[model samples]
Structure formats: C-alpha cells, structure tokens
Target: MAELSGRFRELQDVTSSPTSGVPLSLTQREPEPHANNPPLYDGDPNSCRAFLSQCLLVFALQPRRYATERLKVAYVITLLTGKGREWGSAVWDAGASFCTDFEEFRAEMTKLFDRSVKGDEAASKLARLRQGGRSVTEYAILFKTLAASCDWNEGALRAMFREGLNFDIQDESRLRLRLRRLAPHSSWRLEETLPSKSHPPPQSPLAEPEPMQLGRIRLSAQEKQQRLVQGLCLYCGGSGHFALSCPLKAKAH
Candidate 1:
C-alpha cells in the first residue's frame, strides 16, 4: 500500500511539473474534444454495463488518445455523475493503484455495480411472457430478446415461443400442423374456410334471395301427355311457354 501510494504521488508530481525530467510518455497529455464521450453514468445498476461498454468502444475507436491505462480510467471518471461520480472522485483523490490500470478499474466497477443475474432474469421473464393481443412479429421480437440470455436449447425456445402466442395463433398453428400431416403443400385452405373471430366476412349487398316455390297439384299420365302434346309447360301446366322456358320455373329460381 505504501509503495502504491508513493508511485501514485510520483506520477502526480511528474504530471504537475513541466520539467520534472520524467519520460515523454509519462508527461502530461493535451486536452481532446469530448464529442465522442460516453453517456454519463449515475450509478444505476441496470445501466452500468452499457455505460462501460460505450467507454470501451470509445477507447477502441481512438486508441492513440487513450494509449495509457490512466488516460482510459480518467476519461471514464470524467463521465461519471451522482453516486458514480462520488466513487470515481474518492478513488482519484486518494490516488488508488487500480486507477492506473483500466482493466482492473473495469473489473472493480463491474463487481461493485452489476447486480443482475442475466440468464435467470431472462428465463423468468420469458416464462411469464405472453403474446396477448400483439402480432406474431412483435411477440417473436420480444421473445427472442429474452431467449438470447436464457441459454436454452432450440427445442425449448420453440416450446416457449409457441406457449406465449395468442389462442387464435395457436389454433392456426394446429390447423397448419393438420394440413402438413395430410399432405406436403396441401390444397386445403384453412384461412378461407375458417373465419377469424376478430374479423368476419361481410355479406354482399348485390346478392339476390331465393324465390319461394308454389306446390303443384298431381296430374294423371293422360293429362301430362295431353300437356306435352299441346306444347304446354310440364312444371306448371301453363300454355304460354314450354317447361324449358317456363315463367313459373324462372320465377321460382
């Protein structure tokens, strides 16, 4: 601890002095623009990983700017606020040895602030998730987000996905299964035959209703023969037209 404190003091003195005879690499660095700075973290456990990940990305993109571990750690310190700022400020003021190592700093921050059990949390949420009124696309997107962290096998994922779907979608899936079992690329059109509970087909206004039929009295064979001989209609026994062009038959249709 004493050696680390002395090293920290030496670094501080070397940075503060203009001609301390320190190596060029140990000298103070010029200020850079903060346009690419990561979002400020306020010690929210949920956002800790995301904030650190952004900082890492910035460091990766501009390696020359953050060449030293201290520079990387200092840059992250500047972005902290709230409880995070207090922690960073205390570490910086005390000149902690870990502050000179970015990897150690990151690991410490993760251990301190990251409280989430990602796989367990994801699995719990996925177990309770339901499609409800949402579309299949929307449901699938949400399901996939949780499924990524669950580490479940493909069959388990499929079962969970199907279980979360709306009742209507489940019914359609069952119909699809039946169709597949009947034939590959079956000709049966379930969608056309079965109407949706949400939206039923509308009746056409232009369609005509069937006309009522009138019962005819029984006629003897001689009467029927006489009607046929007289070019009369056999259906109604009308003389104006034959059975093929009968007005009563057309009217009955």
Candidate 2:
C-alpha cells in the first residue's frame, strides 16, 4: 500500500510540473448498439406487444440494459425493408405518417392490429363466448384470453363465462354444482367437465313403443269363399278343410 501511494504521489508530482509537456490521455467511449441483434416487428402477425414486453426481460442482455424508445425505433427501421416485409409495405402503401416516437409507433401498430380493446366491445365478445365443440380446457383458455382484453373482475368474468357455455354444458352434472359453490371472484376448476369428442355423451334414441294386442275376428263369407278357393282351412291351418266341415276345428264344439 505504501509503495502504491508513493508511486501515485510521484506520478502526480510529475504531472503537476509545468515543464512536463505530456498531454493527459482521455479514456471515455460512447456505448455502441449491439450489431448482431435480431430485427423486431417482422409483422407476420400482431407481435409488437409481445416483442416489446419481451424486451423487459433483461436477464440475457449484456450488462442488463433497458430498451429505450429511440433504440427500439432504430431497430424498427431495419424490419421495415426486407424479404417478408408485408407489414412494412402495407404501412408505406397506406402512406401513414411516420411516428414521432416509440409510443406513437406502438399505438399505431396496436390500432392496426385491432388489439386496443374497448370495454363494450370486449364485454360483448366475452358475453357471446361459448364452449362450442372445444373441451373445457380450450374454452377456459379462450375465456381467459378474451377476458384479459377486458377490464371485468374475476367474479363477474366467471359468471359470464359460465352463462355463455352451451345449455348442454351448463346442465352437465357435478360440474355445475361445484362451479356454483366457488366464492365470488375466485378461480373455478373443472374435473373432466367437458367430454372429449372421441367419447361423446351417451345417446339413447326413442325406442318403438309396445304394440297393443287385438282379439281375432271372424272371416267374411267372401273371405271364406276366397279361402276355400285358395284351399286353406278357415279355423285350422290344414289345407283341405273348409270352415263348415272342418273336423279339426269341430272338436271344440
């Protein structure tokens, strides 16, 4: 420590001397942007919000840097002019005015994507939602996703989600009862509420009703003549006998 202090004082003494004509070396540098960073907002889909949100995950950034609007804009310019640049081309063809900053750009992109959800619109969409052919898991996913776009609280959201399901789904056993018992504003769980399409609900079609029995009727003379001509006995099943002289049927009298 003493040796280092002596050396520092000696260097200061040398620098303090007016005759020492060596100019002090400046060692400051401007931070350069990363050259290899991938372009954002390619616009295959409405991914601007996702991209921006992901920028906040600073764990992988060198020295954990924050993404500023100006920096984002610089990257945005690159994505506007390459192969698979439909989003950028659309922007240009429409002759939309350039954004003044990152927030304006994001807003315009969000509006373009129809991602800006109004309360009424979102509520109406959520209100009209139905389980349809999808399973409970799929329906839940869609419900939660649509609900995210709206400002409704969990309790009202759950009620609306339940109400929107198909009548069959609502009338389903234990599921309805359990969902009803949940506390307001709480999560509701399903234990196999919706059946898979592969295993549909048991279907028992209306069977043919029982037929009423009727008493046997006596044959008419025209029918008897027809039977006689046809060589069939009237009362008994023998072929040769007629009704009047039928011996097998005579035993009954």
Residue range 1-253, candidate 1, lDDT tens digits: 2443454455455545555565555324654345476778989997798799899888777665666788778778878888998898789879889998999999989998876447766676776677788765566667666766766654445444544555444466565454344335424322222334564323323334322222333444455434544555556766765444456656655
Looking at model 2, the pairs that clash are none
Q: What is the C-alpha lDDT of each candidate?
A: 0.62, 0.48
lDDT of residue 192 for candidate 2: 29
| Segments in model 2 whose C-alpha atoms lie over 4 Å from true places | 1-48, 55-67, 77-100, 115-117, 166-253
lDDT of 2: 0.48
RMSD of each: 25.0, 27.5
TM-score of candidate 1 against the unseen true structure: 0.49
| Model 1 alpha-carbon drift over 4 Å, by segment | 1-35, 132-142, 167-253
TM per candidate comes to 0.49, 0.41
